[model samples]
Target: MNPQASAQRGSFRHRLVRKKRMANSNEHNAAGYLFIAPWLIGFFLLTLWPIVRSFYLSFTEYSLLEDPTWVGLGNYSEILFKDELFRTSLGVTFTFVVFSVPVKLFCSLMVAMALNKSIRGINFYRTAIYFPSLIGGSIAVSVLWRNMFDLNGYINHVLGWFHIKGVGWLTNPDTSLGTLVLLNAWQFGSTMVIFLAGLKQIPQDLYESAAVDGAGKVRRFFNITLPMLSPVMFFNLVLGVIGSFQMFTSAFVITNGGPVNSTYMYALFLFEKAFKNYQMGYASALAWILLVIIAALTAINFLMSKYWVFYESEGGRAK
Candidate 1:
């Protein structure tokens, strides 16, 4: 072959090979997108779209039966100014979050500390302690709680054995919310597991060194264990606050926000407005308010974490 012809043929072959490789790369990219398409579609339709639509609905007057009519900030105004139930529910929810989150965290940490020991049947103990959390939020559990706390139920029966009178737990306004808080604290299993995981990550040398320094178990825990577990504690605190704010099922199924709305959680109020009263617009406003509250609290937690959440990478100081 002539030299010029040979050069042209070689160049054409190189271009063809490059084009083939480019096509294969495009095909792989398309396949990857196809694999993730379901999740993308669900996120847009089920999550993102509802969030946007709810925000829009919050500004309108809409019952399920009627077309939405723009009401500007009327719903928000009514909720803030005219609604006594709104304030009551908000207070109740805040109380629940304040009491339940800390109690649950403390109880979970204590149980986790016990479970972290090298005792016999430790796996079984862990499972037994964790089992309640798995089913604690279920309707069946709520029903059981209601029966247990009833005036003449098993709790009162047990009290009778000691000649002690049992107060109406889920009946009186004073004790009703406390029952829910106790229920929440009892289901500390998941938090316990997280604490256990954090405990396992602490270096044994740290404990040994503290012991060698004539430090007691309590001193070592304060100097070593707590600092190492601060990140996990912060994680659980944020999650617990968020979860407590959204508490609904227990109040709904157990107390039904009864005894003068004492146990009326903000979420329960929102549900009643949307579904029972058919005031979808007001409910949407309440929902958005809840979202804002959760976001703000989470942001504050993150900010405050810099003061308390110790990190080993930062030499045991929060960054």
Candidate 2:
């Protein structure tokens, strides 16, 4: 073949290859967008729109049936001063978050660590540990929790064997919040699974190297495991705090936020305002306030994490 003709043929083949690669890239991009479109639309319609409307409604007195009356900061003022129950609810919610988040995160991390072993029947163990989270917050589970904490319940039944006197786990105001905190702590399976996945991602060579350096298990965990797992820990911590702050279903079902309103969480307060008292606008304001508080707390956590949360690539350097 002539040299010029051969060169022209090669150029044509290269152009065709480039065109095919471009077409394949466009196809992948289209598919990626298509896969995410449903979630995007759902977020805009159900989440984004409601959030925007709620913020507006926070400044208005809007019964569902009637037009919203502009109330400016009246709702905020009432909540801040006039409403004693609101203050109590805030205190209860804060207490719940303060106690539950750390306990739940710790429990989750421990369980995850236990599960991150080369044991036989690992899947079975995982399933058993995770089963509680699956049925958690259900009406049946709440009923069981109520019974388990009741006077002369299974807990008391077991305590009798040990000759320990039964304390009111759910009935007494002093004990009710603690019972709810325990319940919250028990459902750490989802966080545990997340942690386990994070643990699995850590290279085994690091642990081996640490062992070679004569670091004990505790030292390795503190120096290597915790640092490598910090991102997941941070995620679980933030989520646990948010979930604890919004705790309502268990309190509603088990105690009805009763025993002197000891278990009255913020979401329960909002529910009572919106549905029981027909104060949708006030409830919306509370919801927005809760959102602001959560956002602030999460932001603080993220900022503080820079000091302690070790990344894998951080080379064991303390911030």
Candidate 3:
């Protein structure tokens, strides 16, 4: 072949190879997207679209029966300035989050520490402990809780064995919210599992070294275990706070936001407004307010974490 012809033929072959590789890459990308299309569609339609719509509706006045009328912060103004129930619900929700999150995290961590040990039937124990979380938030469980806390229910009947008169746990405003907090703390199984995983990840050498230095079990836990587990703790804390703030099922099904609305969670209030009263716009406003509150609280947690949440990658506290 002539030298110019040979060069031209080689160039054409190189371009053809490149084009074929590009086509294969595009095909792979398309297939990957096709596999995830369902998730993407559900996320946009079910999650993101509702979020955007709710934000728009927050500024309007709408009952389900009629079209939404733009009211320009009227809903927000009423909620902030005019709604006593809003304040009560906000306080109750905050109280629940404050009381439940720490106790639940602590109980979960304590149980996790115990379960981390090598023992007979450990697998069975772990499974048993975790089973509660799987059904904790279900309507069935909420109904069960309601029944158990009733004035003459199983819980009070059990207390009768000790000759202790059962207080009206679900009836009295003083103890109504406390009962929910206890219920929340009781469902610490998922957090326990996470803590167990984190505990396993801590190096055995750290504990051994601490012991060599005459560190007691408590000392080692404080010095070696907790710092190492700080990242996991931080994760659980944020999630627990967010989850507690959005508590609804128990309040709705069990307490019905009753005992003088003492257990009226912010979520339950928003639900009542939207569903029962048909105040869709007002409910949307409440929802947006909650979203902002959760976001702000999470941001605060992140900001504060730098001082406390230790990561091994940073050699101690996270930067």
Model 1 lDDT tens row, 1-319: 9999999998888667555334444667778889999999999999999999999999998988879999999999999999999999999999999999999999999999998889999999998998999999899999999999999889999999999999889998999999999999989999999999999988888889889999998998898889889999999999999999999999999999987899999999999999999998899999999999999999999999998889888775443
Better of 1 and 3 by lDDT: 1
Tens-place lDDT per residue, model 2, 238-295, is: 8888878888889899998888989888899999999998888999999988989999
Best by lDDT: 1
TM-score between candidate 2 and the true structure: 0.87
The lDDT for every candidate, in the order shown, is 0.93, 0.89, 0.92
Worst 10 residues of 2 by lDDT: 17-26
Is 1 or 2 the stronger prediction by lDDT?
Answer: 1
Local error of candidate 1 at 207, Å? 0.4
TM-score each candidate. Answer: 0.89, 0.87, 0.88
TM-score of 1: 0.89
lDDT of 1 at 114: 91
Model 3 TM-score is 0.88
The parts of candidate 3 lying over 4 Å away from their true place are 1-27, 316-319
Point out where model 1 deviates above 4 Å. Answer: 1-28, 317-319
Q: Write the per-residue lDDT of candidate 3 for residues 1-319, one digit (tens) a residue.
A: 8999999997888567545334444667778889999999999999999999999999998987789999999999999999999999999999999999999999999999999999999999998988888899899998888889889889999999999889889998999999999988989999999999999999898789879999998899888889899999999999999999999889988889999999999999998899999998999999989989999999999999999888888674343
